[model samples]
Target: MKKAWIIWLASTLLLAAALHVAFMFAYPYILMNAAMDRLSANGERENVWTHAPRMTETARLIVRPSPDLAYSSCVYDLSDGPVQISVQPWGDYMSLSLFGANTDNYFTLNDRRMPESGAIVILRTADQAITDEQRAAAFEVVDSPSARGIALVRRLAPSPERFAEAEAARVQEECRALNAE
Candidate 1:
């Protein structure tokens, strides 16, 4: 009876360990889902960038957001069609990152990678093939695995005072849904 009780206890511990591991893995998914929901509620519908206020001691949208950087985000729904992003690299440090529904960052580009045209146009193609017109444009095309996602534009501000400059730069950026034609 002693040996049987020990075995049962071990089995229970193992099951609990497995369950904890599973929850650890699922935690990010749950958090991302909640964040997406909040973003949809707060952000402009779709394909329009919404600049977030500068991070402060009271600000809590992103976990531990840095005051040294400014953020702008756009929720994307590519089920109907692909989306295009146009950015003017203005700051000393700037980056654009694409995050899928699962919170996985699939693509990122920084100021160093900015095109020579003084602007960068990125096309996130849906699961389907791109149109001939999209091929004709001077845009960087990338096939996206997920149709619903978020586009984040981050810019480094040298000081809290510079946040406005970064915001100004990002406000000029454009996130637009491409026409099916």
Candidate 2:
């Protein structure tokens, strides 16, 4: 029955299309969530760096990471309010990127953006409002959309000989939750 075969083929094609569309929309979010879960559960928790020296070895928190770049990640929880981030411009190429739960990069900073002093400080918060005193003290205030997120630090280590220097720089980066005033 050609008619019945045609109906089945069309229905199957439609179902496949629908499934594909759904997966396409949901894949990024799902991937981000899974990465966050592994990151938070890996005992690093919030405000501490989880170093991944060999990026070729597939990390639980990042997909298709590059070995040429050394990585350090910190999960930030804004439930208690603001957090302090400090970076020492110890290398030629270094970057810090903040990503929210929805996989949006809300803020990013690099060595080139740092002051001549070769150090940078950031006050990050998800609070909708801030007092004048707080604003005055903030060197670089970042207003985030979500209460929880991750901060990633990337340092270029093109070869094994350069890895130690990059690792030293990565270790110098500081991320800590500030005590509420």
Candidate 1 residue lDDT tens string, 1-181: 9999999999999999999999988887788767766766744467778788877889867787877788888888777777878777764888888888778998888888877544545556555566677666735776666777788888888586688777777777888877644
Worst 10 residues of 2 by lDDT: 119-128
Clashes (candidate 1): 0
Residue 30 error for model 1, in Å? 1.3
lDDT of 2 by residue, 64-181 (tens): 7787888887777777767767666745788888898778997888878876545444445544455667566555778767777788888888888788887776676667775543
- For candidate 1, give the lDDT: 0.76
lDDT (Cα atoms) of all candidates against the true structure? 0.76, 0.73
Stretches of candidate 1 off by over 4 Å are 1-22, 42-44, 118-126
TM-score of each: 0.79, 0.74
Residue pairs clashing in model 1 are: none
Residue 80's lDDT in candidate 2: 72
Best lDDT among the predictions, by candidate number: 1
Query: Residue 152 error for model 1, in Å?
Result: 1.0
